[model samples]
Target: MVFVTAGALDGPLLTATLRLRADHAPPGTRSRVFAVGAGLEITAATSGTALAGAAAGLPAPVLLLAVAASHAVAGLLHPVLRGTARSPAALSEATSASRRVQ
Candidate 1:
């Protein structure tokens, strides 16, 4: 339990630090993408270890599977979400629609 707590804390703390670094980085989509990946990796790695430790009562293979799943969800899932938000023109579509309504 204690181990899990200590290790689990790694993700959020690292994420906050990464966010600050990301903010200071060049203002561009590339920076934003990097920041997101850094955060996700930190979270997945931290949480993966924590969860793996807690899996003592479970089967060994199960532990590996869970940790891998967590990593995938963190690293891959977030980039997809961020990717979908990339279309700057989508916002303009809303503005054009509003103009037409007015």
Candidate 2:
């Protein structure tokens, strides 16, 4: 049931992430950008699965805590990283740079 719920939630998140990536990718390099993004996602998932398999001997509580901590860290970092990328100056510079490239 938990796995099913997680999978259901993951679908929309993945869709939105891919859409966001596609929207921001430079015009001529959209395909390349998507390829790279997909490659990275695959690599991350594979690495995570491998890590979990290696850690299978750990206590369930420990494993669950580790997962929770990782999610907490990511949630905290998201705002900081996003703010940096979406700042007014950063956005203006990116826009001008993309315009210049065209």
Candidate 3:
């Protein structure tokens, strides 16, 4: 069903998101970062469920379009947000330095 398909699609995205969070979090704060990320994800899911319930009467096409639009916005934002993060070279150097210290 559609729900199963959606859940399957979400698997890789969730994994990548967690990996990215781990990569970006400060060395001593990875657990806190993951906890915060999970809490936020849960809050967002709850909010989305409430919104969907409230919009239950809306036409299916309209809801679908809204979902598509949100996806498009997220896709566009990804590059812009990524640009603000440390580059891969910097991250590798930091990792190497940390390994040396350990």
Candidate 4:
């Protein structure tokens, strides 16, 4: 259950990061993608082991709260990973719609 929750929260963010890197990388260059994969692999291995160690002997509610807090921190960092905002055209459309609503 913890793995499933974490995966659901992380999958799309990781996918978006990969897609963004792929689109911006040089044509025919897969090095960036590989780098991202390697980083994720390393992070998962170390963090998973550490988390498991910490959660051991902890109360179930405490572990769940820790997981939720970690996800919340990840959520906060997601916007930075998202890079720039939408294009001016999209921004203008959004503004116009809001103006109409007002």
Candidate 5:
């Protein structure tokens, strides 16, 4: 049930965020945007798990509400940050280029 809800919410949010990031971020910054987004995702997942674990003593309803609230916050924030789209050639060039370093 949790996976189902998470997938339903996260799938579209991830798609839109990636599309916007590709559309709004500057050429020189796209890689950095991707890197930062990836890092945040990892951190969020880790933090959420730890928080949930630490809250294990709470009632199931309260824990669920907390999880939902966190997801809501993430959903609300996603659209406020946007990125620029790379042109086909630029994307191709980026793909052929060596990985970008932070």
Candidate 6:
């Protein structure tokens, strides 16, 4: 399973993502430290998206702002969707029990 969020604006942008896998691990290792972290940041007079965002196919500046405002409102509702999501809680117990029998 995975989760992701991203936001962009005039000054800066923020993004985050996470993924969990239910794969096998070495014997006796109750838990594993998979790729625990990642990050990136860049600054310059211009950024790649700047040109693409201004190109013909893209929406005009005003339209873009309106779209952003709409998403800003929808973003507030994001938690409602994720609140019902589940993680691998009971599966860990089942994994350990099955390992014991093996």
TM-score of each: 0.35, 0.74, 0.69, 0.50, 0.56, 0.29
**Model 4 lDDT tens row, 1-102:** 999999899889879867866655544346965687779878988999997997799999999998899999999988987676565467557767877999
Please report the candidate that would top lDDT against the real structure: 3
Query: lDDT tens digits, residues 10-75, model 2?
Result: 999999998888767756678988999999999999999999899999999999999999999999
- Residue range with the least summed lDDT across 10 consecutive positions in model 5: 79-88
Question: Which pairs clash (backbone N, Cα, C closer than 3 Å) in model 2?
Answer: none
Q: Model 2 residue 28 lDDT?
A: 63
lDDT of 6 by residue, 1-102 (tens): 123323234224322222232233323442443322221223222554575566547557866886698799889878987686544554567766898999
- Count of clashes, each model: 0, 0, 0, 0, 9, 0
**Global lDDT of each candidate:** 0.73, 0.86, 0.89, 0.78, 0.80, 0.50
Residue 33 C-alpha lDDT in model 4:
59
Clashing residue pairs found in predicted model 5 = 22-84, 22-85, 23-83, 23-84, 23-85, 24-83, 24-84, 25-83, 25-84
Residue range 1-102, candidate 5, lDDT tens digits: 999998899989999989977875667779998999889989989998898788989999997888799899988877665245456677756755745542
Return the lDDT, model 2, position 75. 100
Clash count, predicted structure 3: 0
> Model 3: residues >4 Å from true position, as ranges?
88-102
Clash list (residue pairs), candidate 4: none
**Lowest summed lDDT window (length 10), candidate 6:** 13-22
Give me the displacement of residue 72 in model 6, in angstroms.
1.6
Overall local distance difference test of candidate 2 = 0.86
Ordered list by lDDT, greatest first: 3, 2, 5, 4, 1, 6
Task: Report the Cα lDDT for residue 33, model 3.
Answer: 85
Per residue, candidate 1 scores C-alpha lDDT tens digits across 1-102 of 999998899789878977755554444354776868778987978987786667779987987787789788889889888887635456556656777999
